[model samples]
Target: MRILLVLVAAAGLFGCAALPGDGPAAINITTQDVEDSAQSGDYTVVTIDPGNIDAIRSYRPMAFANQFRGVGRGGSPTLLGVGDTLTVSIWEASPDGLFSSGDSGSSQIPSVVDEHGYIFVPYAGRVRAAGLSIEGLRQSVQKKLIGKAVEPQVLISLRDKLSSTAVVVGDVAKPGVYPLPLRDTRLLDLVAQAGGAREATYETVVTLKRGNRAGTTRLEDLIDYPENNVLISPNDNILLSHRPRTFSAFGAVKANQLVPFRTKSVTMAEALATVGGLRDERADANGVFLFRYEDAELVRRLKPELAEKLAGAETVPLVYKLGLRDPKGFFMSQHFEMRDKDILYVSNHPTAELGKFLQIIAPLISNYSTVQRITD
Candidate 1:
């Protein structure tokens, strides 16, 4: 009997020591600690209420598609530039005109625009072609040949484009400098010409760099929103990149693992569901937490009152708590947006440790009693 009691007591003590709270890295945190942490100036603790939900939703980054709404569609004629090749056809009304060739009274001249932005014609010296539209250049040549030729008529068209080219590189199968078409070329047109993005649409990010400004949008957004497929300009640098967004699930969950979102946006409830939901037997319904670092400027815009209270906190490491004990908490989870690199943790109930201790000793006590009765 003494041996049975000793064995039972040892098992109980071992189980208690193996509990999560007794470890150096404790997984269990009380509500008091979460609330006091903010007052202690250790970290910001945001209890997700209706007001907090509104603030967080308001501060989330706007859809990449929204930034491209103002981008204009392709319709404008392409301007000529230096290093472009032009094919000019000039016709003379008279048989003895300067440009006459047998009964045709016309000549086709292929000229490349020089560094001086001018192209030379047979009788019309050097005429400016760069920065002028095809029709504009034709009129300029006709004006020059008015007295030199008999009722001169001219037609100008782009033979080749060398100076007006855009660099389409990064995450593309055929990345290179692509020439801008005579008609305005839009974003998707250039991408398609370059063999499209190598990565999946949802995982791809497209960045457009024009002069000193740069803008980024998801490739899926460009495909879904026609307005986002804006016109591409000369010398624009286009980059396609793959950056997958993911969140980590830890503690008391069905399966603790890094979960990747298949869509551009995902809600907290959906993220929890993806990790197989919480482990019902061990999970503390009131101790679910989400950890992330938020932008200070965004916080200021969304939660000005809280922003003022945490003026000195620069890194803005925030912990958002949700109590699933209430039925409405599940509804609130639907509204909470999950961001990249976020940590979702569901702690175990305090009584669960004692339950575990009991489980470990119950079988041992039963076995010990059977042995003692047999010996008696």
Candidate 2:
């Protein structure tokens, strides 16, 4: 009975043997095995160094000027459309002229473009205004009243624009459809008109949809890069959203939390620092790994040999190792940027697992000896 009690206590304590960074034997993969697999073309592995850092930077997606070319610009004036209100003023040279009102020989007419793109004039009849600029419509009205009126001079101006507008929604202080002005209105102008984004600049993502085409850009980049704030086109839909970039930290890091980047880009060192760095006692200094899915085209450009192994893959799974034991590794970490959704894992020191096993069994051994003494 005494021996059986000791065996039961030992078995119960052995159940707690699993430690940090320990996994099932079938799934356990060592750092050396990862390195060997990368060398054998089973997976792409990159060492975080100055040259590789520059290569990764080259592959980083850049925000270019929205190349959506259409009708909205300074070169082309705002054309008339349905539901647009216009003010027409006609002037005559003589007091007894056709539009004489209280001897001023001028009249102000308020007209709205109809469904058929035409506006009515007393003598000019139904005149087509849609698809014509303000100046163009003025010329059309003058030509219609040429024979009837005495050398009529016409001027036209937009009173209220209703048809030509862009819809702004999501993550803004005010979400509504804003009308585009007669002059060229830009993307930033429309966003400002809607009361600006509710989130931080770095956290905001602005997507522009024009017709069937769509483009997305970071709000911060749009503000910093002038070209990204392109002219807003009619019927364009602007969506402002907050999608904060983050990366996951696991294994022997001091704090294993989903860390968010405060800026557009964060270096590996910055990410590690944000998470309180690696645990000195448990972390294996040479086993830091960053896991991410990289674009195949970029992989091909950077490492053709690895690219060949992943020919059929759209995106290649890549793991980058950083040896913190080396004095120069700290410098390399500063250059290596941590992309969104990346996983930063620091494997535990091999001896740490053995120490944990000893810790769990030591209590069981003491309990067993105490039970034996009681039985005796």
lDDT of 2 by residue, 54-152 (tens): 787665443334346553442114788998998999998777887878856799999999999999988999999999988899999999999888889
Q: What tens-digit string does per-residue lDDT give for candidate 1 at 207-244?
A: 98877657787787677677677787777789999888
Candidate 1's error at 251, in angstroms?
Answer: 1.3
What's the CA RMSD for each of the models?
5.5, 5.5
The Cα RMSD of model 1 versus the native structure comes to: 5.5
TM-score of each: 0.70, 0.75
lDDT of each structure? Answer: 0.78, 0.78
